[model samples]
Target chain A: MYLAKIFVTHKKSILDPQGEAIKNALHRLDYEAVENVSQGKYFETTLNCDSEDKAKQITDSICDSLLANPNMETYRFEIEKVGD
Target chain B: MKFAVISFPGSNCDYDMYYAIKDILKEPVEMVSCDTESLDGFDAVLIPGGFSYGDYLRSGAIAKFAKVMPALIKFANLGKPVLGVCNGFQILTEVGLLPGSLQNNRDMQFISEYEPLIVQNNKTIFTNEYEKAESIMIPIAHGEGNYYCNETELESLKQNHQIIFTYENNPNGSVSNIAGITNKNGNVMGMMPHPERAVEKILGSEDGVRLFTSILKSFKGGILVE
Candidate 1:
């Protein structure tokens, strides 16, 4: 078995307004030392596959097709063996 | 012209679009479901505002996979008129029918009010009734109405005059003050403003009524004989 974790976020050039707002709020709360903040979505799933290669393929395909909008977002995922 | 208003799972403005077409314009219109596989017999397609799919993943990230999307793509390929408003606009971008994506407002607020919009291109079927550079008030209500496109796409959009509308005061901080845009072919349009919600003076402004008239007039060969 494999456990896959995916993270999706706006592209570097894209303006993340929600993240900017959060940064502002942090400053208001006296967290002025923080220079930047990026926000994104995270997903975890247990793949019923035994091979790491198969798990990676499934996770990548899902991220490309649905988990992120390529026009403004990018995603990265990691897979690890869980149980036999 | 007969129009089809697609009603996704969380669509709340479907009826508003229907009324704008059927009652106000006196044109034939029907409410289509997201599960519908065919858009046959419809001259135009309307995707109305609202949080489709409860905006679960993103505003429109999950809606491009709806059963009706394939048919919608075929309809657009035929050069038929397709208008997406608000969340509908978001869906079109997700489907790659239109360029750019709608993001959270710069101020991170859900803005809901009458906003001034300038008709940038009056030659297209969607804005033919308005004069070039004419400004009109329309209602815009959304949390993610800020539009963003890459520099290259923005340059091409400007060069081709594909930009249909721009805001007067730049309410949502959209790039280039863009409020609405069309595909290079000019058949498909997506706008963040709710023109359907401003069709009558009773509602607030009737400026948006001309937009519907424009589509109908184009179907009648750009002029009404009667």
Candidate 2:
């Protein structure tokens, strides 16, 4: 078994509306000095596979195909062999 | 034509849609709960606008795993027509049925007003009633309705004419002023406005009546007369 964790985010320079909203909220609450915020989703999943390399391949494909938008967002994946 | 409007627990616009379809358009409609397993009989499935699950854990994140979404996916995959409005639009993007993420409004505040929507693509089942480049007024009420898709996807969408409606004045800061989009097959549509609310003159606008009528016309195997 392997555990894969992924982080999906908008590419740098793309505006993040959620992050901007949070920044606005902070300023409204008087936290005026808070600067530069970005929001992203973190996904962790366990996959049953033969080897670490095979798990990596499957996980990468999922990220590219559906898990994350390769064009607007970039994703990073970490895989580890684990005993269930 | 038979249509079903899926109502989530926190959904507030189910009856609005029901009245829009049944009362205004004089079409037979069903108010279906979000957990319904069978959508095989309906000609169209509508995910009405509302703040589902009280907008928890991101706008449509929690509603994605509802009982009826799997059935909705099946309905969409079979090339049936599906329309998601407002919160329903957010839900579609979250489920990967649509391409972009609907984030907070550009001003970081909830906006509720009548905004002009320019029809960009009239080839889809949803927009067939309108002439290309026509503009109509509809109400948008959302705190998080900004649409974001990468540049590559944006170009492809334009190339394919998948972008159906664009904001007339950049209301929510959506990329390229996009207000709505259709799936690659053009069967599914998701938009960030409440067309149902604008279906009657009593609501201050009747421009939305054409949308429902257009869809019904298509289902009857006829083109929109207007």
Candidate 3:
């Protein structure tokens, strides 16, 4: 088995309104040193693939087709062998 | 002409779209579930607003995977009109039927109110009933209506006259104050405003009636009557 950890976030060119709101709230709490916050999504999935290379390819396709919107967000994933 | 309002799970405005077409526009309309495999026999498709898939991953993110989407894409490719409003608009972008994605409103609030919209390009089938540069009132209710696209796409939209509407006052900080846009072919339109909500004077404004009328006129193969 292989476990894939994925992260999706809005591209830097797009405005992160939710993250901006959270940053403002943090500043109100006197966290002035905090300059920015960008919100994103995280997901973990396990696949019954034979090899790490196959799992990586499947995970990448999933990210491209379903997990991420290429127009507004970017995604990255890491695959690790979990079991024999 | 027949119109089909696609009903995705959690779609709240599908009936409204149906009512606007059947009752107000005096046209035939049907409600189709998102799981249906084919959109055959429909003259046009209307994707209504709502929290499809509970808006789980993102607005219209999961809903784009619906079984009916392939049919919708085929219908669009045939140059049949496809109108997507609010969450429908988001789905169009997610499905690649339309360009650009809707981001959360800059204010981060769920806004529901009447806003003025300028008819940016009245040449398309969806907006042909309205005059160019005409100002009309439409109700906009969404938290993720801020439209975004790359600079090159923005330039092309302008060059192609695909921008159909612009907010009079820029409510959500959308790029270029874009309230609505159409695809390059002009048969597909994705707009954040709810024209279905403003179809009657009793509902507050009749400005939205012209939009639906435009579609009907196109199907009838006639010129604009009013």
- Candidate 3 chain B, run of 10 with poorest lDDT: B217-226
Question: By summed lDDT, which 10 consecutive residues of candidate 1 chain A come out lowest?
Answer: A10-19
Judge candidate 1 at residue B147 and give its lDDT.
96
lDDT-best of 2 and 3: 3
lDDT, candidate 1, B88-121, per-residue tens: 9999999999999999999999999999999999
CAPRI grade of model 1: high
Clash pairs (backbone) in predicted model 1: none
CA lDDT, every prediction?
0.93, 0.85, 0.93
lDDT of 2 by residue, B90-164 (tens): 989888898878877888779999999999987777877899999999999988888988778899889888899
Give per-residue CA lDDT, model 3, range B15-125, as digits (tens). Answer: 999999999998889999999999999989999999999998889999989999889999999889999999999999999999989989999999999999999998888
Better candidate number, 1 or 2, judged by lDDT: 1
User: Candidate 3 — which residues are off by over 4 angstroms?
Assistant: B222-226
TM-score of chain A of each: 0.95, 0.87, 0.96
Worst 10-residue stretch by lDDT in candidate 1 chain B? B217-226
Clashing pairs in 2: none
